[model samples]
Target chain A: MSAPVVELVGLTRTFPGPPPVHALDGVDLVVRAGEYVSVVGPSGSGKSTLLHVLGLLDRPTGGDYLLDGVPTSTTSERHRARLRGGRIGFVFQQFHLLPHRSVLDNVLLATLYSGVPRAERVDRARAALERVGLDHRVDAAPTTLSGGERQRVAVARAVVTGPSLLLADEPTGNLDSVSSAAVMDLFDELHASGLTLVVITHDPVVSARAQRRVRISDGLLAEL
Target chain B: MRRRAAPVALEDVLELAEAETPPPPPPPRRRRWWGRPWRRGDGFDLRDLLAEGVASVGARPGRLALTMLGTVLGIASLVVTVGLAQTAAGQVGRQFDAVAATQVVVRPGSVLTQSGEERATGRLPWDAEERVERLAGVEDAGALAAVDLGGAPVTAVPVNDPSAPAAVSPPVVAASPGLLDAVRGRVVTGRSFDAGHDARADRVVVLGARAAERLGVGRVDRQPTVFLGEVPYTVIGVVDGVQRRTDLLDAVLVPLGTARADLGLAAPEELQVRIEVGAGPLVARQAPVALDPGSDDAFDVEAPPERSRAREAVQADLNATFLALGAVALLVGGLGIANVTLLSVLERRGEIGLRRAVGATRRQVAGQFLVESVVLGLLGGVVGASLGVLVVVGVSVVQAWTPVLDLPTAFGSALLGGLIGLVAGAYPAVKAATVEPITALRGGV
Candidate 1:
């Protein structure tokens, strides 16, 4: 119903070897604006490779990826980086946060490369942290926070740039049940407010929270 | 759609909606044949780059200090060695100036006779001292000659002991009053014969210190007398420190007029002129012409080489030896910086990868590391320069020599550290720029 934020057509990724391995094979998918999509797959099911291609971190061998109406498959590295910084947000399972920096500083780092204005970066980072329900802990270091709090800080960093699409790779794989539900509730609130999200996970319960689910296996995808 | 039961804040929704709308894209332009389309404000601001660099460099203080030690020692040693060389050379030059650099000797030119025998061509004027002293930079000038007593057996005692073993006779020398000053010799006892004695042709002599000792004359207060070929001369004084013409110490010196009147002496053979240091060549050239204006080559003059030339030669030698040592230390310092920077790159691969993922261009990533190393080098340079100055001053103070340090050289050495850092950081910065975001994020090589 809405404008497509992510479009994948005939996406293929093959690693060069004595016998080449195709990690992504003829994958086709569309994530519309304001949609919450979950990609479910088992180990060695090409999930990581697909996520990488979708995140614009890896180049697809043969395909067209249209991010926000821009054909990005043929774009230069600089242009892709610009798009990745200003248009896309990523959340990895490890919650890559600088342990030495404060929560506010970690969130502010995302704005540094995303073309955020110098005068407004701090205010924007604070606002993003508040939205994640961690306004009281903006000055705390990541190492001092629990696993769930660190994940929340990572989320704040991801959304600080107001990316058009948010990509999460196993956002709750390391979290307890209580924290997982809380993170899912936060995602639901974000999706209800018209933010597009694509979450990759292996858990059935996690995938069930999304409006649309796609299972990936052997380098191909089937909608469920 | 599966809706969540939790309520969402209206402001949160509004903020998300507002942020979701991306900044307006630039108007499309004609595609260039080479390179990508130019984007406005694409890279980092200089202020932000510097801030990030400082933060990262300050993150590990212990490692930073350890890495800077090599550069510190390199620059400090370079400055110290060069400074000490200059200071020590100055000390040696001063001693040289006092003696060798200040003295000039002139002698009558020799001519070949019909029989192929060498004979003196021209004689020095009787008033050679007065004539040469008028020249600028001439401190003292005098005339002297070895007098032939015609087989005279000179003795301190009136009678010669012919029955005893034959004793060697001390030669007699006739010198003008200015000779003592020219030779830079000081009288050890009583007084030297003055111009009055020369004018009156007085039979007075200043014995050399060793000659006085040989003659058993301890003090001139008793008015000791020595006989030169049956002529008696009063021992007015004894000279000890003969800086130039050291042979004067053993000779019995008498008044020039007295030698000509009593001993039938001819014109003086040689003239000794003590010029100011650094004025050797000027005085040497003018002294020969001043002695005999009729002929430029009337006298052969020997002056020490130019003071600056000798000083420069010594300085050059010192520079060559010390600079090699400094260069080796500097090279080691550069290698240390490179090795540490490379190790830092490898250790922080994840951080570099994350920076790349955050839309940092390869150049920006490299710039950060470059700035870090340059700052390290600059800091080391400052510290090393200060230390070098302190050591040079300390050594100079201890050795009681004047410390000579070129300020520009010290400042330039500090900047050289920055240059070394630049060269040392190049490879590591390139390596850091090459890190791929995907592999880095996946925690692979």
Candidate 2:
């Protein structure tokens, strides 16, 4: 269905040095539409590199990447950016929320690069916040939010554009156990609503919630 | 009346097949020159850029204000210099019109003979005033002679007291009776010599204000006598304020006939003519002809230029000096902007990385920083221009001058500040844009 939302074949990324570090080496992965998948690994296991490559933030040194059956390996930077803006959403471990912006404005910022029409951006952003259970705190600044609420706002921002695939890297890494559990529950609800989700984490509790699990070690991948 | 309603059918309510037609595609949106068509769902909005730019500027108000000081000083100096130059030019013009412009000097030309001796080629006739006065624009005319006394030093006191300070020999000049009016001289005390004194060659003399002070003869009522190379002449008047020949305020003036008769003075050396307003050119042209019809070429007439050329040259030099100073100030301001902007780029690496990760293009990141710098410069420009104009007005008011300011100078300074900001922002914006997202996310190199 939907030609499998994402497919990677023999993807490889290397950091140059006297002895180059192969952060991701010949990794192949595929996720069908609406699937909830977790890529789990310990530190220095290339989980972050895989997530970066998938989100189009970092280029793969070798491999083929397809999103919705469209080849992206040879796409120009401008085209890649357009695809990232319209078709993919990312959540970072740091939340990366702008301190100066209100919770609503942060959500609205998703439409800033997505080309959402000015008239509909506010309503769409509001609806996303509502889905993340943050409608009551729309006008509050991000500094005022608890860790759980901030992460939730970040989630709303990621989904505001209705991106086809959501990529989260260490989504619960900085949150308390209770807040992390709450954020994981929110992820489950979003997945149940038929949105494709990929989470990269070393935490067993976070990985256990995914419908399918994949393990990464020494730049290689295996299914569990 | 009975109305029969059609039975509501679930199939009729569901018209799902008709609903498949996508409601007339959301009204077409406009495209920005820089952005892709809105329907592409991939273009950033201009408003978004502006919002981010404003947010960044507001984030560091104190730093922004400090950075703005440089531009303000630069623009302020430029505007003030231009404004004052205009006002000073206006004052110089009025002074020129009042004195030099209305007065023309006509002097006899000398030719070097084959014998290697200088001889007067054309001498003003004894009736020079009458001839020149006949011209249409001549308001007043008079002849003057230096009346050389053969280098003989004359003193106020007849007794050669060796104990007295060294004798001062002020030059003696002889003038026609109407010279006072032609030269715009005012009688400070007593009276000037009349036609009777000139016709009879009377020994009456008018002491210039400075000359009277030099001779220690302050009052004409006392009838003090000044010995001009051993001939005593009665002091009839003390004159001051000679507008045309200000240097003559230090000379002793006697009747022309008296000087020629007693002091052995030759023919008059110069003809002084005052004309009606705007008659300088006409009188300058016709006066030489009126004085010597055949030897008109032998006389040289000096007329004021139409627009105060000498004063304008002085004004230009003043403006150049002040503008150079302004340029230095502006240069310093531009450097300040560059320094602060570079620092901002370094401090905001985290923000830059975040924006990049959120799908902003490199150009967009560069554009945001550029806009912020430009906004800073524009703000400084506005404040500086306003302050500069106010300073100009304030100084003019204190100096009793009319303020002069043009529109372009006022607005152009602001534009110049903006331009400076633009140039200053270039290196920093490039640095901000080139920071790799992965490195910036790690918060360091």
Candidate 3:
């Protein structure tokens, strides 16, 4: 791939404190098209911060990061959010679905800032849920769903946008072994279908499953 | 080989692209702004939320009813108060306009006089008022002197027949042209006293129509004369009828000179003083019509009209007391509306947060909430005004009074309701505007 999907150079992030916590330190990384990369780190190793920055949820303290061959350091917050919505999909371990809404509604909320038409929302939501094999539970309240099923619903919400990148943050952290394997298989299938997938996890199994693994400790990525 | 060879190149490529990855369906057919104005197209769609919002409220009608009830009662009270006060003001204006300040009265003393008791004081004669006119700044003056018909019951002998109606003692008042504009009884049957009649001491008298009927008189155009203690006084004109204002009827009107001659008195009949240009009377005379010495209840030598106004003032005080109580209800209602609006702001914080997160500015949120509150208050005003009218009708029906509603009363009360809304909603709306979106979305009060 002549133009990498992601490129980060000399990334440094520091928090204000008595002893300023260095969340990220001079990290350099790259991923080409259709690559499945997993990042692993111990506690306080800046795993989530790295994921949030990649997902455009937070402004970087210092970095030269390019997305789709375009420099992201100069991008405005609004542009970042649009790019995040249109070009990158997110999967969080906690699901974070609104409990008051139905499964259909929770998935539809992901599409709110994307400017979808109001008329076709219901049908579209139903179709998204069907893809995750929960079409029968379209109107079921989110609090009623099983853990694995809820994670699948979250996955459905993420992939409904058909973005070029899939950013999963500890995707299987809340699942048991069997459910974890099932989700991993789904990730494998998506990768085979040519999505650029990034999974942030400490799971050795997930690390082994990805075609590439990037390990970090104390805010620096180790060359392996 | 299996597929038809027709358009094979284009068809196969299109199918392959679709199988690999689908394009984004041309950005979801960009909807017209009115059709889908909001950018977040997937919001609880109007249909979903409208039904759901209503359902959310309907799920507990008891609470909803209580909320709405507070608004309803507040509005009703305001409307009723405004309407009743309007009616009272209207009736008083009409009555005042019909028989306005006609003449001035002068007694032996000033209003605050500590002289001899009012009953012993003398009434200014008809000629005395004419004398005052000669003083600088004095204008045309007349006298319409009166004595109580209810006091010292006297003998009455009918002019046409002595035994007619057995007996009737009408309230006798001696008046001249000055009283014409003051009484509802205008001369309809005969002509008024011209200068010739007064100078000649013609004794031509104008009878009130009711008194004329009582005396069995012919059409007064011929100008007949009747005996006052067997002293014949000519009939000059007859008025339609005198007003029965608080049981005082102006039944007999005679020129001052004629009355003086008839009574054989050196002093003139009661005097009426007039200032040059509508200035209220400076001095007045009152002979306590019904009082002895050392009494606070002594009747005054005030102009009959002035005394009537005093009576009106007392009635007005009573009216004001009721009106003030009504206003209190309105004020309480206004406060209730404000309180409810505040509670609504707090309760709907989540909804406000959601709207803000979707790009609503703080002003828009405040404006929407305020508009809702005002609309609520104004609706209450309309109802309250109606209740006010109802109150007027009830009072009049029960007391035989013609209470009324007027333009200013209506306008004032309606505006008062709006003012209440503005006053009450101000702080709450500010509080709502100060709310932070992120904090509200976090749902921590």
The DockQ assigned to candidate 3 is 0.10
The candidates, ranked best first by DockQ, are: 1, 2, 3
Query: What is every candidate's C-alpha DockQ against the true complex, given to 2 decimals?
Result: 0.21, 0.21, 0.10
Per-residue accuracy of model 3 over A1-224 as CA lDDT, tens digit each: 44588888888778888999899998899988779999999978998778766776555789787888777777875566556655676777766565556788667655554455666656666776785679999889878988788888877767665566788988898899988887887677667657788999999998899998889899999854
Backbone N/Cα/C clashes per model = 0, 0, 17
Q: Itemize residue pairs with steric clashes in candidate 1.
A: none
| Candidate 3 lDDT by residue in tens digits, B103-164 | 44443432444665433334444444445555443354555655333343222232566565
Tens-place lDDT digits, model 2, residues B290-309: 99899788888997766556
lDDT of each: 0.85, 0.84, 0.61
Q: Residue B347 of model 3: what lDDT?
A: 77
TM-score for model 1?
0.83
What does fnat come to for each candidate? 0.26, 0.30, 0.08
Q: Candidate 2's interface RMSD, please? A: 9.1
Which consecutive 10 residues in model 3 chain B have the weakest lDDT in total?
B28-37
Question: Model 3 misses residue B285 by how many Å?
Answer: 30
- Clash tally for model 3: 17
Mark the regions of model 3 whose C-alpha exceeds 4 Å error after superposition: A117-123, A177-182, B1-173, B176-252, B255-445
Scored by TM-score, the top model is 1
